[model samples]
Target: MTAPDPAAAAAPSFDIRREVVAVMPHLRAFARFLTGNRERADDLVQDAVVRCLQAAHQFQPGTNFKAWMFTILRNLFYNEGRKNRVKLDPLDEMNAGAHAMPPDQQAGLEFDDFRRAFWHLNEEQREVLILVGASGMSYDEAAAICGVAVGTIKSRVSRARAQLARVMEGGGLGSRTSGNQEMPAEMAAFLAAGTPPKGR
Candidate 1:
């Protein structure tokens, strides 16, 4: 009998690696939302990719690979947090002032204020918001990733929105509409872009 072809034998692993690479942009965006720092986000993505490769055998086929990878990334983030409480630097006011939008750019200012309020939210609140609100995942999916009840994820998203509204209002943005009102246009656009705010 001819010896088995090693490359053919490794094809499954290679396929999984390609899938991981395919979702890297999404992973990087999520990481940026989680870390609020580009450099740290890149490192987090790298670490998550490594963990995924190491645990490749444990990954069941015919599953939601993106969700699986996201779960791994989230767990890795929390694990590292527990081991070494990483501290991110505060947003740079000087940089913000230097890049300040023109006075007529009211929408830009509102978006900037929203970004500031977003970072002020607690990690749990922020995570739920990003997962459901920004990332467009269903509450059920977010709940699974968060290991919480569906209602808990909903509650977190609601509280996060309320808190963000309060923060913006406190910053002289005025009261937002109530009762399932549409989110602010600027906020919606910002979240849709999924990019970290300047000076974060």
Candidate 2:
């Protein structure tokens, strides 16, 4: 028999890398939600991508690649969190340049307030919301990544939404044009985007 083609042998690995790169934005957004620090978030994404590359052989084809990558990222985040508590630097002038927004715009101000409220959420709540509500993962998929039951994921999402509603209604942020009865349209768009909002 002829020797196997080297290019053919490497095809799967190359495809996996391509797919991983395609999802980098989502990974970074998730990392941001987890760390709340831009630099740390980038580091976390880098680590997760490295881990994914090293473990590519274990990834099953036709499975949900996004979910698998997210599991890797969440595992990495928790593992690192256990090793060292992350210290977040304040968003000062030095760092502000990285994510500059027009202060005069109403949408920008509202987004900033929403981000503050989002970060104020407990870790579990934040994770669940980002995974299900923002990242658009189904509850079952999120449950598997989070290592919890589907019901648990659903409950976390429900409570997180209610809490966010309360926060917005109570002026934890500013008044939303969507009114107090529902989540603001901008916040809903942000959650459903499954990636970092613009200027984030």
Candidate 3:
């Protein structure tokens, strides 16, 4: 009998890798939205792809590979999120609001302020908001990834927006000044503009 053809054996694997590359733009977008930065997003996507390839056997053929890959990416995000220990820099207490810089300086400070504000949100709320708002995922898809009901996702998104608003306002980075409020109105709209819908 002829020896097994190793090259032939890896052909199927090559096809799977090709499919993954084809979906990379979307995956990168999702990762960037979730992490709120390009470097972290690229790392996340790379990690997800590696994990997916390692667990290729688990994937069922003739099914939705895109969805399957997305599920893997989402799971990895949550797993790492729980382990994230990046500490946020605290504001100076002795010199509260001692900002003496120009408006240009304030602009850069405002970006850092927004980043810190996002870090303050509960993990679940942040995840829901990013998936639904920044990543362009629908409530249903985000809910599935989060393993929660549509209502739960909506609630989380709402609370996230409200919490962000409160944080910005308290930190003197209100919408009128923050320029987009960091949390876009389209994202906050999920909170029904910070109010419940009618008859609720």
Candidate 4:
């Protein structure tokens, strides 16, 4: 068999600007989920596009550029998330699981409920939950990103879960099995200690 020319065998180089534009719709969707504001989502997407273009060389052609760009955008949003709280309706859930309700409708309801429950949690708990549950990061990775210990992350996740349960309960979604569900005292103490003092 004849060997193909090294140059001829190579695929054409990918156009960073073109690619970024093509992914704009998807990027906007991601930004909306991240910031919950159309204007801010546009700004964030523009910023991510600029960053992606600036470091175009970092992207390998014929590979998953979209995923790479998304990762950058997601990280940037997380870095600024606390300063800009995502506005979500309590009726719209992000996780509209398998049911008769349309996915979009269900997601909105889920997002809403999640948003309400999420706010009741302290910062550490919220961050851990979002990182692990929404962003899909592992506990260790979340700890590293937050610059904290693994045990600390574990504790935060546990507390966050408990807090979510309580918040949901307070929202009238708690199971009847758990009568008068309340946030455990120990968990409350941990939360109080871990949360940064206001105006700090």
Candidate 5:
């Protein structure tokens, strides 16, 4: 019997490590969205990264690496949330310092406005929007990551947008500046891109 080469056995682990490094910022942002705290989000990202490295061998070829990592982090967040009874509150307090790229001012929907409108949305609606619309993942990719049907993901994004639009149009949300608000689709995507890594 021929002896197995150590380097050959470890090649996939190397690849996984590199991919994880590249995807870390994204994981942090998503974790912050889910956990609603920077410290807790960082911890979740660390745990998820460890889990990914430990399970590297199980990572299949041709799979979407970012999606896979996101799924792991999300599962961790929900699992821990269940154990700790974490309340899913409005995200105004979460990642207060961290922000996505500023969208067009001409669009007439400021990030502050978008963030406020986002607060009015339910958790599930925000979740799908982040996955599909903000994160720039295709509906199929998002559906796979979210473990839902493509149509379901599409419906969530549509409903989330429509509801947000209505929130802008129909005022009376507490602390939000009074006006007839409008959120362009491109603006949503830009604002969803999130800030850079290391708590920036």
Candidate 6:
């Protein structure tokens, strides 16, 4: 057999691989929130990584690699929905963050309230909230990943916050689930903590 050019078979760039490693926690969190199950969420992230590595040549330099990776994972969620649904995991994994929660905090009874109430949010609401509010993505980045207009992304985020707050309030808190209200403290803290690792 003829010798092949080793240069042509060079691996994905060190930068991309580093970013992918940094982004894994966020990707896992996003997948868990979207799929509403832990094991399947891990599976989704694994598949997305494999797909990303296979298509690394298509990655455009000086662009948003985080957004690019998220777009891949999001596409997998939709395109592979049938196979995914058969996993039959309950939306019971609605803590969403699963492992993302700070160790001491998530075990509180308050999060139980947060969990059931969060599960009340429709998937679209949850997705946008996680992307913009939790994952620390820009509005433009979220819109592009969602394949929606910027305005629509804004609307969904606004509504997601409102709905999340409303649901929690209405739940034993006895606050108004009405009017446009943003997510309350625990939600904010959770979202804040949900951001991807920052070391680069």
Error of 1 at 147 (Å): 0.8
TM-score per candidate = 0.73, 0.73, 0.57, 0.45, 0.72, 0.70
Model-by-model lDDT, in order? 0.71, 0.75, 0.66, 0.63, 0.71, 0.75
Rank by lDDT (best first): 6, 2, 1, 5, 3, 4
Model 3 root mean square deviation, Cα atoms: 8.4
- Runs off by more than 4 Å, candidate 2: 1-9, 88-109, 172-200
Stretches of candidate 4 off by over 4 Å are 1-34, 58-71, 78-115, 119-127, 140-152, 172-200
lDDT for position 47 in model 4: 85
**Candidate 3: stretches off by over 4 Å:** 1-15, 32-41, 60-66, 80-85, 88-120, 174-192, 195-200
Off by over 4 Å in 5: 1-10, 89-109, 174-200
For candidate 6, write residues 56-169 as lDDT tens digits.
889887788889889999999989965646553445565444436554443444555566666777778889988998899999999999999999999897777667766664
Model 2 whole-model lDDT (C-alpha atoms): 0.75
Per-residue CA lDDT of model 3 for 61-166, tens digit only, reads 7766766777787788878844872332333321233344454564545545565566566656667776777766788878777788999988888888887756
Q: How much does candidate 5 score in TM-score? A: 0.72
Count clashing residue pairs in model 5.
Answer: 0
Write the residue-wise lDDT of candidate 4 on 113-183 in tens digits. 54555655655575677666765567776666666788998888877787775675554542222344454
Candidate 2 lDDT tens digits, 1-200: 46566777757654775688788999998888777777878888898999998998898988889899999999988987657746644343123432257765556556665665666677788899999988989999999999999999988888887666556545644443344445557666645543333477
Q: Which stretch of 10 consecutive residues in model 6 shows the poorest summed lDDT?
A: 170-179
Candidate 6, number of clashes: 0
Candidate 2 Cα deviation (angstroms), residue 27: 0.4
- Predict model 5's lDDT versus the native: 0.71
Q: Cα-based RMSD of the predictions, in order? A: 9.0, 8.3, 8.4, 9.6, 9.5, 9.8
